[model samples]
Target: MGTFITCAVTGGADTVSRHPRIPVTPKEIADAAISAAKAGAAIVHLHARDPKTGQQSRDPELFTEIVSLIRDSDTDVIINVSCGMAGDLILTDTPETQPAGAGTDLLGPRGRLQHLDRLCRDPRLKPEICTLDCGSMNFGDGDLVYLAPATYLRPMAQHIRSLGIKPELEVFELGHLAFVQKMSAEGLLDGAPLIQFCLGIPGGAPAEPFILDAFKQLAPTGSVWSAFAIGRDELRFVSLAAGQGGNVRVGLEDNLYLEKGVFADNDTLVERAVGLIRGMGGSVMNAADTRQKLGLDRAH
Candidate 1:
């Protein structure tokens, strides 16, 4: 099958101020996703934010509204909401006083999946795929961490599978990939598991070609995989991923620039990726073809 693109429209990053137009409101995010689909993205990976404050939120209603907006539209882009929220753990100098500091938004598995649960009540609003962060890691500099231990992840994966949603295994490093393999061995994942190699984060694996080659080699056989790198390396990895016979992802979530000193929106990033893929002599798969390739259920 040909390569497909997944556009991560807006994330929990502090990019709203960095760029002129970051999709913060539910309508804006939905519009960005739809526009990206029109620009040749097969899937639109999404996250919800507070409309007024432009801050990150895990509120199920916000997600429901966003999904509703997208589904109501004519676009048939595959929806993939993040289950990676509410997992941040910030440390304090006085460990006893503040184990999880002010920035921390840590929650157990159920709280993390609440948004997906809310959307699942209506088949039409249910996302075709949701993310499952394979393991925990130090997110960036400072004491902040992205906490997703195996104990929490196992149950989260089970719940995601039970909901009839494909879990995109997001791995930041080799250890995370190992945990994913362990889950697959325990019969937690269904069908050919979808994996996403997330590289070039401050505390994660470097976004180097050799690193991607290693990840591709270690990944489970027959698993459908895609990859992305944050910031400047985002576009570079698009070509690298496509050239290596895998899928590609691009959007303002992971990058804010179409080029140096040039701010970008979701649609432009997807369009640039489409150009890169076609430039590499690769066929860009549409949403229907990607659904078939990934075995996504579209009964809704």
Candidate 2:
């Protein structure tokens, strides 16, 4: 009945230049995940980056190397690979080029699953869970769009289920949760849906108490849900979520500072989350207990 923490070690955001240390390489990312696990994170969410340029990458090879390192290190943590990459749709003003311009990496549902397909084929590389972004949204206040329509999500969910990987339904806004309910009603999702309320992103839900309360009420009943906000509100949501009978997530991916002007790594962010949950009189769940609770397959 205690809350569990999911540390999103590194996200696909362009945050390398902003933070002194953001885990750009496979080794660094794997090391961050392992360290966070040691610091009491039950799950480590991951996103790969281009080693040479430090740009976000959906390359299966990078993921292969990253997961191999984690599994080889004998770390006991749930691996949740992000399937939310390659969905950027940057709008172009040029009439000739039309919709997509530079930085557009849109792909079909199956195309987006290329990395998962490669990883799941190898028993040793298959992660315990993978994310399924439930809807499309403006990436920010810019021309970029994170496109993942219902058509794309249905097949993606079905495919993730087929791979025997638990799907973490990431809802960025209230409307997205409605789609989750629909997907659940249609049986696209397996087991009690694992939901993550992603707040504080521009053009998405704001990281506020009233909004979080609304999300909690609107989320599907019986869902194993966690909530997080970006930047300053990241750790604050940890306290909010646990106080409301929900799990929490925190890491450098969401926030880069332990406090004002202080850089934070994955482990410290997780350690802070542990303190918050424990101080609230809530126990923390380990990787094994998390798997059982989420109905995930045994770790390979």
Candidate 3:
């Protein structure tokens, strides 16, 4: 199992306030992605933000501009736009009120896939792959939930399949993996399923070696798996995952620091991950190799 490294350039959430180097505009994102690709990342997991306020945006225009910029560049990195953006819900309560203050939230699967349809419909901007968060969880911060019931996931899987885009099943916990396997058994996910193990998020799987090993054992048979850890456990899990015959993911989207109190940029993260993989006698797969390995058809 050769290692394939993916750099999550910018997530469509509130990381800008935490990291000064998080790219906000399409130009910045495109540049960061290209830099990561040049360093070692084969796939660039992308999420767009509002240029002015740095708020997450699922608007097709923003996604289109970002994808186009990268496609026009010399970088040949495979693009993976996040379909994980639209399902977030944030609710705030008023101090004096019983219910709460004004917050944010979105309901239903159709609402979540609205942005996905826009991206998939644009022939010039179609991503070769998009994420399918298998199960709902309490996304860190505030009283919010990232909802993805089986009813929602089944249809979303069908929709992504119809679009000819590979769905990267993101499993944050053991049960999430089970759900993905069930979906695969149901003929929703095509080919050998691609699974991403997300570790060390609040309310999700903790960043423990044993936990990762358990999850690895639970991964769908014949599925391709990649692993990532957030915050302090980033590099530790990178080495562990690569050593354990799984690919690796590392970026500011998961961890803002390269070292204690040391802020790192996206390219630096990619470079470090590549170094670790190579140091461990693992070869990093290129975009073409990754596409072939993951059974993905190139986007024209």
Candidate 4:
């Protein structure tokens, strides 16, 4: 089977602290995405951030600027915006002491989709796909928990369905995949659902061969599935997922180094993925075919 590779640019959080060139501004983000598309990525996934402070943001204006720049560049790539921001639940020192600490960014379904809604107003700026974190789980070993309980997901899923845009279900655990499959059965999701297996996270499934095999068994039938792992497992999963009849994702969002201590940019990562896919005897897909396969709306 052919592969659909997506380059996840700068992540959903502050990455400037992690690496020198993490793409904080709109122009930088757009430029990185353009380069990724040229390097053979079918889609470019984006997460907004404050231009000045290099902090993560869900600002519609920021998204507008990024989308506009990408569109104006005449780049032929699918734009996959992120809607993963949640009302953070942070319990400082003790649960009773600081129930909602300084790091907490608690928000409801509507609040999380605010930026997505604003983007839809302009057909040219609308994204073809946006992420939907499948379930609530403790974010890493920290005091924060990324909450996406039934209450939030029910309405949020409905909103995404109404928009008629695809929601790439971000599955951190097997249970998350099971829940989204149920939602699809109930007709809350549109088209052939796209499920992204996100492994190697702190509180979720580790990047192991057996776990990936199990996730494939649990994934919904007739769904477009892609998988990615953080850090070193990132490149390895490319061949593994393709061998298992799934697509793959790669970029700076998951790893900074192209090699041992060698920091790489978004374009470099995309080029590597292209080489890997071709090396595996699988052809890399372009944006137009990817849109047709995933049932995504086109940019005007």
Best by lDDT: 1
- Tens digits of per-residue lDDT for model 1 on 1-300? 799999999998988889989999999999999999999999999999999989899999999999999999979899999999988988988998767788889889988999999999998998999999998899788898899998999999999999999999999999999988899899999999899999999889999999999999888888999999999999999999999999999999999999999999899999999999999899999999999999987977
Model 2: ten consecutive residues of lowest lDDT:
94-103
The TM-scores of all predictions, comma-separated, are: 0.99, 0.98, 0.94, 0.97
* Overall local distance difference test of candidate 2: 0.93
lDDT for 186 (candidate 4):
89
Best by TM-score: 1
Rank the candidate models, highest lDDT first: 1, 2, 4, 3
- TM-score for candidate 1, please give it: 0.99
lDDT of 3 at 273: 93
Error of 1 at 222 (Å): 0.7
Point out where model 2 deviates above 4 Å: 95-97
Model 3 residue runs over 4 Å out of place are 91-101
Which ten residues in a row are the worst by lDDT in model 4?
Answer: 91-100
| C-alpha RMSD of each candidate structure in angstroms | 0.8, 1.0, 2.1, 1.1
Q: State the lDDT of candidate 4 residue by residue for 10-36, as single tens digits.
A: 997656888989988999999999999
